[model samples]
Target: METKHIIITGTSRGIGFELALQFANAGHKVLAISRKTPQALLGHSNISCLSIDLSIEEDLEKVTQFIEHTWKKVDVLIHNAGVLLLKPFDQISAKEFEDIYKVNVFAVANLTRCCIPYLQKGSHVVTVSSMGGIQGSMKFAGLAAYSSSKGAVITLSELLAEEYKEKGVAFNVLALGAVQTEMLQEAFPGYQAPISAKEMADYIFNFALTGNKYYNGKVLQVSSTTP
Candidate 1:
């Protein structure tokens, strides 16, 4: 297998951490980015970690510099970091809503822009979204900001796919359902998800590697439940 250089965001825990570990263990080089580095990922020969807030523009340069001075190319870029804001529309403040969009939507766009030059043909860009983001999906009252941000990224990926189609870089979105993770627990306290973080990460791992061959600018509904 060819050694691919992969960049994954939101690796502090849950699905992001699992994705980083799986890729590294498989002999692929992984650059894991999160606000806080995961201790368990340290010492992994194949994994390099960066601690930065994705919403911070200047902090993103560290990633670009890392790629220019080190990896030089990116085979896959996964936008897995997201912030959730669960509040009634009326009670939500503009600042709180903007905060979610900054991390979940704007950051994805910024990071992808920084990595565009390094992405070549056959490169895949996958944005992790929620099932609630899909049109006509079961709507949650409290996830207005979170779900809307996810939906925005879905459209953004589609547009990116079109813009880069001639260049051969593929972009796609995965609208996921309930996955048992810290984020999920925060969104729905005491609720048990049918899938585990590791399980979801495994699925995303396979998809990120080869899904672009059959899909581009597509949103796959990866859910088994309504919520």
Candidate 2:
């Protein structure tokens, strides 16, 4: 496999961390960004961890500049960072909604905008969305803020695909179902997780490397029962 410079957000732990590990193990240079550096990634030769809170607008520019200076270009950009605030609709504070949007929507847009100039042909832009972003099942009550933000991300990816298709940059969204991650634990405490983070990571990494044009602008849903 040819080595590529991959940029992944929300890599402190969970799906993002696992994605970074899988890509780095496959000989790619992975730049993992998160609010704090994970100790497990301290000495990885193929991985470089950047501490940046994507919710902060100022940090987005810094991250983009850092990537441009260090890697010059990004072959694969994964927007995997997100937030979930489970609270009653009436109890959800304005601050909580703003926080979720900052990380899940605004930050994604900012990062993608910054990377556009540096993205070249054959580069892939993948956003990690959610099933809630799709059909909006009523299984969960306190997920209004989180689900709406993810829905916006899915829309953004589709729009980006259309805008960048002529330039050969592929854009897609991964609408993942329940997976065993820190976020999952927070959402469903005391319940056994149905899927593993490693499993999801492997699937996503393989899909991105397939170089298939069929997946461009597609919202691929992954669940335990689907595969």
Candidate 3:
């Protein structure tokens, strides 16, 4: 297998952490970004840990500049950092909404824009979205803000895919369903899920490596049924 250089956001925990380890184990060079470096990933030859707060535009600019200086191009750019605010619409403050969009939509867009110059043909960009992005759940009483932001990410991925298709760059969204992670536990305190972050990470990494052209611009939903 060819060794690819991949950049992944939210690597301090959950799916992002697993993805980083899996990619590095597969002989890929991974640049993992998060607010702070996790001790577990402190020193890995194939992994470069970057401290970046995606909510800050200046920080993202610095990251982009660093990537441009250090690497020729990124083979895969995975926007996996996100925030979840579960509160009633009325209870959702302006600052909360801003925070959600900052990390979920704006950061992803800014990073994608910055990476365009460095991204080569055949490169893939994947956004980690949620099942809420696809179908609304009335059962989950207060998830409007989070759901809306993810929905926007899904659309953004589709539009980006079309815009970059001619250049051989692919944009896709993974609408993950009930993955067992810290985020899941926080979202649904008592709920149990069949999917684990490791399982999801394995699928995502394989998909990134072997997915066909037809998979571009699609929202691939990975649920309990998914393997």
Q: Pick the TM-score winner.
A: 1
lDDT of 1 by residue, 89-165 (tens): 99999999999999999999999999999999999999999988898899989899999999999999999999999
lDDT agreement of model 1 with the native? 0.96
Question: Which of candidates 1 and 2 reaches a greater lDDT?
Answer: 1
- lDDT value, residue 167 of candidate 1: 96
Off by over 4 Å in 3: 135-139, 225-227
In candidate 3, how many Å is residue 92 off? Answer: 0.6
Q: Write the per-residue lDDT of candidate 3 for residues 44-152, one digit (tens) a residue.
A: 8889888988988888787677777877788999999998988899999999998999999999999899899888888999999987878543235588888889999
The predictions' CA RMSDs to the true structure, in order, are: 0.8, 1.7, 2.0
Q: Give per-residue lDDT, candidate 3, residue 88.
A: 90
Cα lDDT of candidate 3 equals 0.87
Clashing pairs in 2: none
Off by over 4 Å in 1: none
Full-model lDDT for every candidate: 0.96, 0.86, 0.87
Candidate 1: worst 10 consecutive residues by lDDT?
218-227
TM-scores of the candidates are 0.99, 0.95, 0.94
